[model samples]
Target: MSAALRPFDVAAIRAEFPILQQQLEGKPLVYLDNAATTQKPMAVIQAITDYYSQCNANVHRGAHQLADEATRRFELSRDKVASFIQAYDRCEVIWTSGTTEAINIVANGIAQRLKPGDEVLVTEMEHHANLVTWQQACLRSGASLKIVPIHDNGALDTEAFAALLSANTRLVALPHVSNALGTVNPIQDLTRLAKAHGALVLIDGAQGIAHGGVNVREIGCDFYAFSGHKVFGPTGVGVLWGKAEVLQDWPVWQTGGEMIAQVTYHSATWGELPNRLEAGTPNIAGVIGLAAAIDWLTQFDVSAIQAHERALLAYATTLATDFEGIQLVGTAADKIGVFSFVLQGSHPADVGFLLDKQGIAIRTGSHCAQPLMQRLGLPGTARASFSVYNTLEEVDALFRALKKTQRMLA
Candidate 1:
């Protein structure tokens, strides 16, 4: 919590986003599906429009005036991203399509070092994107994947994570925050344990970064990945931050026009860290929009935002606690602003549909985390995730809607 900020005013903050003012079915929208993707503000939208309309040109290749302006804006975005995460160097950052692609980049690029008997350790709580890529990587390189178990409360069993690290462990990958459960892992300690076994660490910040700040050098993880859409930015752009040295050593996963240094008919050299990773014209508008989103987000007081979310989460939990047959899926000590729960007799999809009729938006089903759903011994749960834009009034509306839903089923 920063000292300069005062207590958050939800009403004041809500005014900035015009989309939230709209109605569905003659009712005001109550958007509770933030974990799926946050709604973008006018700032982010305007940033994209401004870039294409004014400074429309290619970057890094042209010597002309418009090209130089485009290049400057693009590089400014890079610096903004680097500062947002507190990266050691701006060059450590590389852009990708989204979290899935970022994770895949590491999985595929690191394949050159993996061989039979080498292990890539993960956990049971991982999203399929994280799980499947490593599964394929292990299959290709003859490396094996290991899963660390979670406690019944949905928190990572850190003791179990420590116990799983062996001499053959080459990589340990985990999420900073679980998209399904909202569990915030102790990544610092996890990284330390992995480092003790001479294993590199990759922390998936897809669900974590948008809600809170991240310091890459402080966390000391080898790699961190997150998506733009999750953070009020455009959908197509994502970030993969690595220690510059580690990124330099990883084999190039993609190759094309922009990534090349010299070309013969036979062999060619590649560009530097980011340029080598980015192989084409890139998502120009998406990147610019993301930069605008980051800039807009940075303007608010983070402490106030955190306090508001915590209060709203507490309120939501109180309402949910009274439902007799309902079961809260994840009760981890450290959770973000997400709630996943199931009524004993109700299917998640049915609840989702009913809520939509009330002009309430929430996500239901596996949430790209089918394994986690199976672990909880359920088909799925309806999840309501909050952001800075959500209000106590919206939370009350959700509770009223849920009570209505429970009665209709009864």
Candidate 2:
């Protein structure tokens, strides 16, 4: 089907992922752990295989035929990432290990310029990746780290966010979507607010990248970071899209390999925007596979996929509402299909264990937002995150299994 013409067919979509067509024990596998890492489709697998089997070589430094092919595909992947996020320029796309490394690059660079009294604002909803990096940066620079509050329902407190901003607020780091709560923050509005306060904004786009169309220029953030694996691409590869003007003269994050322009025993000049930040050999196959994943994703109508996911969330929510012995976590008005809850009188880990007996895979525990869990007064939560390929039948199966789990626990 044409990119514009293909309608979302869940059966067809599920068929593309070989892992989904499996049985764990005697029960059919119902994978609901998408928020951790998406299953790779054949397209991504084939792309990686083609790269290794046909043209595997070091990029950008050789005159051989294999090197030329490798470099072409590797750089084209950069263009794909730039176009995917609507970046200002392809050079603005810097490859990193993943979102953690991407944010580290920014945090480390900013640490060089931060002053003692400078303040950094981050939300309570941040994954530790966004939180810890900035926290350590503040520690290194003697800057103060301020946290923006979230409501009991897990929605970001916009009013409190505004109140926290000040002339001394040097940066505002926020998650585009809360990994634990599935709360989708109003990034564009929040970005505008930070810009008015003259603070640079960085969006941790790990969860938001695949859910909706992302336009970095439209959002007006100084930097946006996302992982390839979160969007059904390869792990160990990610993109850091920053405004060219902001990144062009920024302090270099790494100092070796192609990032250097001139070398001496004592002094070396750094290269331009992207290469200046990307040091050493990159995950070439992972990048190519990520591009292929992007190509595969764009083939389906994004709106249809979104609609399907919404229906799944709504149906699951309805079932959760009527289902006894369950208390929902992170009931934000705006959220993705991450159904997090705890059965009454049972630990989240226990619920997850019982669900797994029925072949339902869910993520249990704090989900890397320990502070958010503390704020919400939960030891942890059982999370069933969704994706475009998930089906309503699978959701039904989840609840059915949950009922059995609750009974077993009771």
Best by TM-score, which number?
2
> Worst lDDT window (10 residues) for model 1?
1-10
Give lDDT per model, in order: 0.88, 0.91
Please provide, for model 1 over 1-410, each residue's C-alpha lDDT reduced to its tens digit, 9 standing for 90 to 100: 46655446677767778899999878999999988899898988998898898988898888798888888888888899999999989888898999999999999887878999999999988999888889899999999999999999899999989999999999999999888988989999899889999999999999988886788887889999999999999998999999998998678878898888898999999988788898988887888888998987887677666777778888888887876777888889899888888877999998889889999999999989888888888899999999999988999998888888888877
Question: What TM-score does prediction 2 earn?
Answer: 0.98
TM-score, one value per model? 0.97, 0.98
lDDT score for residue 10 of model 1: 70
Q: Model 1's lDDT to the true fold?
A: 0.88
lDDT of 2 at 158: 98
Q: Can you give the lDDT of residue 248 in candidate 1? A: 88
The collision pairs in model 1 are none
